[model samples]
Target: MGMIKDAQVSVRDLFRWRQRTVTVDEQGNEHVTFETPSTPPNPIRLLRSISMLGWGAYLIGFFCWTADAFDFHALSIQTVKLSQHFGISRTEISTAVTLTLLLRSVGAAIFGIFSDYFGRKYPLTVNMWILGALQVGSIYAPSWNTFLAIRALFGLGMGGVYGAAAGMALENIPVEARGLMSGIFQQGYSFGYVLAACTNLGVGGATSSWPIMFWVGAAMSFAAGFARLIFPESKQFIEARQNSKGSSTAQFAKNFGKMLKLEWKVCVYSIILMSWFNWFSHTSQDSYTTFMLVGKELNNAAASRASILMKTGAVVGGTFVGYFSQWLGRRRAMIIACFMVCCLIPAWILPETESGLEGGGFMLQFFVQGAWGVVPVYLSEISPPAFRAIFVGLTYQLGNAISAPSTQIINALSDSHTIRNHTGRVVAAYGPVMGIATAIIAVGLALTAAVGPEKKGASFESAAAATTAEAVTDISAAAAPSKAHQSSSVGQATSEEDLAGKKGANGDSHAVLTKTEYA
Candidate 1:
């Protein structure tokens, strides 16, 4: 009931224009105040603030991310065909998905840190190339063991893409436009799903034709990588480099250690939040095509069409909710979307006719991915300025790792359960199982979001500048006492003691600072 009311208020807030003002107090604490606005900022003018180079970086990032999604979904949407081709149960094929998700965290940790220290260009380009090559490699795998090995390798490449792509895409955009752009950027995943479904529809359901989709995925990956090669590094990254002292292995390690020590709570919270979100998406979408085919008794063509429609809804919902989040607030947007999903569950999975199933699938995914659309910017806002790429990628992929078994769990449970099909034959109860799982996940996600921290409208550039200034101040302070002693020995000792106390006080303040106040 409380959730329903919040959802209502969230919807109402979308239509009401409001102005948010940030004020800093004497202690440097920020207070946010909101009021009714007579006129809102022009959306078109807001968009024009992004430079041509910013658009290029965003597009390349979106394309690379889309290509990665295409490669992964190609296998997932073709689960039945792959199962037949490999002469294994659908449950066994799901193991490959599990393995892929399980290894993503490893890649995220490696490539995320590398991207943070060096730049997004080299690490992201290499990851895309690796993904393309692996997509091709999967087509020629002789045995199930070899196939799983390729998929596990694919996860590593896939994991690196999200952090690099998200950082490059969102970092340079104006804060006012980030919500809308984030929505559009996150739709790359949904668009990739749509593309995979279209490809499946074109190639037909023959087990032999699965290789064609892989070929297409490989081509897309390579194309995205090549496109990125022509673009310069992200503007924010370039500015950050200019203002910093220098990057090195030792400096990076020290920074990373300090971040972990000071920001461990945020890190843990993000991982938990991401874990729920990953499960929400995976459990709802991964086996959806299979559910349509077996549970609804739809033909491959109908199932593929329905899958396309479902993801189309995801694209639209993500965009709308993402834009709305700018005014409604990130946490509110997510909470509302999650509660809405709970209401749509019955429609999502219980419909008997193809059109009914289509409508249900579309509406459910609309809200599901709508919540997801806020994720990129929300994660970016809370991330430490210097380690945006690594922090965003590692937390997200670690959550992916935690929820890696969603598909397998769904398949295994559904296989064990039975239901009567239209033909009156007992079949895996995919629909009911998925519906129940989605409801639980949606509720869990909503509750988690309700209690979580938000750093909406945080300024990344300012944070970076503050960090640099603080470092410089520390250096100057350390060197000051050595230059001259203008006091007696007793006075010097007292001044030294006071300085130590001040340092301790500053350390405590730094330790307690929120992600938005990191500097």
Candidate 2:
């Protein structure tokens, strides 16, 4: 009943233009409050709050992420062509997809930690260059074995992009705009798919034209790398680095170990949640074009058009739902989106005509990616201060690693079953296989989201400040002569006047510090 009432209020507030505020109590705990604003800030006002530099960072992140998606979807969208080129079964081609996803966790772990410690710019730039070079490698692979190997290597660079990109994109935005921006940011994946589809359409269905798409993907990757070069490090990261100037590599490692020890549960939960999300998107999308061509007997152009429309729905749905999540609350928004997706599974895979398929596909992906829009900010909120990049990237890629076999699994299942298509020809039962799999995944996702934690509107700045303050304190303590001296130093460091000044200046750092001490 309490949950029901909260849901009702959230729904009501969605229409009311409420503003969220955070207040600190005497004990240095933050309390979030929402109240109706006299007039909602217009989009221009919201955009103005982010400033030009913030937008630059956000756009660069978005562009790199989009390029990552394009490189990935290029292969998935052209699976049939690739299978023909390699003279192998479609399932065999999917093995490359599986291998690529399976190794992303390694890349994420390596580059995520690097970005967190050094900076996002260099690691991200290098990752893009690596992706470009690998795409070029894929273009000229001499044989089946060589193609598979290159794709597996491509996964490493691909894995590192999301964490750093997400950290750079969302960390600098105002809290009020994060939901809207997160939705738009996440749609880079869908947009990449749309772009891939358009490229596929333009190049025609000739088997030889597949390499053209790879070339395009390589160019995009290189472009994203160059674009990132024009941007500087994130402002929040710079400030945090300045504040923790005394910390050494050994202390950094020790702090990371302590974070893992204390926040292991959150880490585990994030990985589990991300696994479901990965499965959710890949299961619905990876084989969709193949499903159209094989099950519905559509031609390449028809399939590409349907794919574009479907992902267009994804972009629109993700943006709206992501924006609404600000008022709907993160968990509630995700739960609702997952439920809608489950309801749409039948329509998503059952249409016969091209128009019907396009409509259903669009609506289905709208909700599918809608749930994904909350992920960037939600992950950021849950991550420990000083580890946002690694936490977000590693968890997301680990989830990808776990769900790496999604496309292969779907292909294998479909090949074993036979179903009659619209023209009365027997084909792989992709529709039923994909539909059943998606339904089960959607239900599980909704349940997982319902039970999972939320830290909506969490202050990244406050957390960074708290971590910096703690690092400074540790340094002072290490330099002290004795235990009594350390205690006196600590007391002086956290004197009431100093604490009050910090609270007055930042309003939430003191609360974050209090929580960090106990955590």
Candidate 3:
């Protein structure tokens, strides 16, 4: 068929398949591309629908972040209470907090892999339940070991939720909203932190009423997870599933292989950025200022309040960054955020007299911390659609893996200075070193971000086209019947556009459909 006549067929095919690729299941042991179809889009309605999904995913991020804030610190305060009850030393009780963060990274990794294989919805829902369960159960644990072990297990749920959520966030939002949504997604951590601090203060004092904190997390997780379960799966993941078949967990491994073959750039990006983003966010949000303020003679209430202010800044920065980055594009927004990091971090160490002084405590806690809204947006924009769930999980967990151990080390190292009260003295002692370390980390990230940054509010298909087009063609070909034809070039053609006339699952015609590699 010629271009014009084929265009009409393509339009109908587009509507029929909705730009989702089609494949064939060959006895569960093998697969082949049945056909490739032209991009299908109800651009107007699709955009709106996707935007709604973005919002829903954003809510997921919000809920997860809030839960983490509640749960992440579960060990910190609970260790104090449980230690008194169980007669364990403060250091020994510390395992509850430490292990939780550490173990959650495993959750993120495993669940992330599951999300890739099973799709994002189920894993996401399950993770929420885990969080809620831990909150409810941890309140009444009989032994210190059991309490700590369960709390650590909760981290796994926390780990799995976001990367999958990140996948959904990208799919649900339109190309235009990618940057903003990314910011919104990433902002969850900071917002969650703020939510935690405020919740702690609101729900009776932690000193007398630490158990209330767990109750609050449980309640929120239940409500949100319940509401969230009704939300739709990421169209991206759904589309991918429909194009392939057979529910065996082994397919998960196969899909990862496809992902590796198709989108290695994204994988590289995930690994590289994961370290910086995860470590810095974890270190700063979970520990630093609280430790410093406590060391400097600040009361728990005052320190908690300071944490609230800082995390609130992060929330605000993220919420605003989401929309703002939509206008600016992901890379530029990230560049701006990177510059902000460079600017905000050095204040951590300056002498009180030398430091800007008046709001230095607040600045370190909130402003510097608040600048974290950059990561989600970047990751969301960069990932491949087919492999999103898996990649997000992998990259995010990879980051967490690096951060989890590092946070523990930071805790161990900083434990010596013991910032019980005075905020000033604490900043004087540890703030500068942390600030420098963070800045160095930021600069290193800035270098890798040299991938010329993505433009905001453009066609996602086009953005991913160059990277994914060939893989799409190959995967489609693999599922095709013997009739599928290729350009007779062994990828020596230098461009995917050269290949033509491929049929996909429903026997649709498309320009990109050549032949599946396995087919």
Candidate 2 residue-wise lDDT at 430: 97
lDDT of 3 by residue, 1-519 (tens): 232332233223222322222222222112222133333333345446554556666676566655655666655533344556678655566556566656666787688777766666777777787788888888888777778777777777777777776666565566544544555566666666666667665654444576777787788777667766887776655554555445454544554566576445446556766776666666555555444343444445555666666666666666555555444433444545666767766454443332232245445434333335656655554454445555666677767666666555554555554332233343323453456566776677555554422313322332111123333443444334343333343221112233234544565443332222110
Q: Considering every candidate listed, which one attains the maximal TM-score?
A: 2
Q: What's the candidate order when arranged by decreasing TM-score?
A: 2, 1, 3
lDDT of 3: 0.54
Query: Over 4 Å off in model 1, which ranges?
Result: 1-42, 463-519
TM-score preference between candidates 2 and 3, better one: 2
**Highest-scoring model, lDDT:** 2
Give the clashing pairs for model 2.
none
lDDT of each: 0.79, 0.80, 0.54
Q: In model 3, which runs have C-alpha deviations exceeding 4 angstroms?
A: 1-61, 76-95, 203-208, 239-252, 261-265, 327-329, 346-358, 361-371, 417-428, 451-519
How far off is model 1, as Cα RMSD? 8.8
Instruction: Kindly list the per-residue Cα lDDT of model 2 for residues 120-190, writing each as its tens digit.
Output: 89999999999999999999899999999999999999999999999888888998898889999999989
Q: Give TM per candidate.
A: 0.85, 0.86, 0.70
Per-residue CA lDDT of model 1 for 1-519, tens digit only, reads 433443343344334344222322222233333333333356688789898877888888899989999999989999999999999999999999999999999999999987876788888888899999999999999999999999999999999999999988987788888888999899999999999999999999788999999999999999988887778876666675676664456656666676676556568878999999999999999999999888877999999999999999999999888988887778788999998999999888877888888899899999999999999998887676667888899999999999999999999999999999777888899988999999999999887776555456765564332134333332223223332333422110121122233332224111112112221
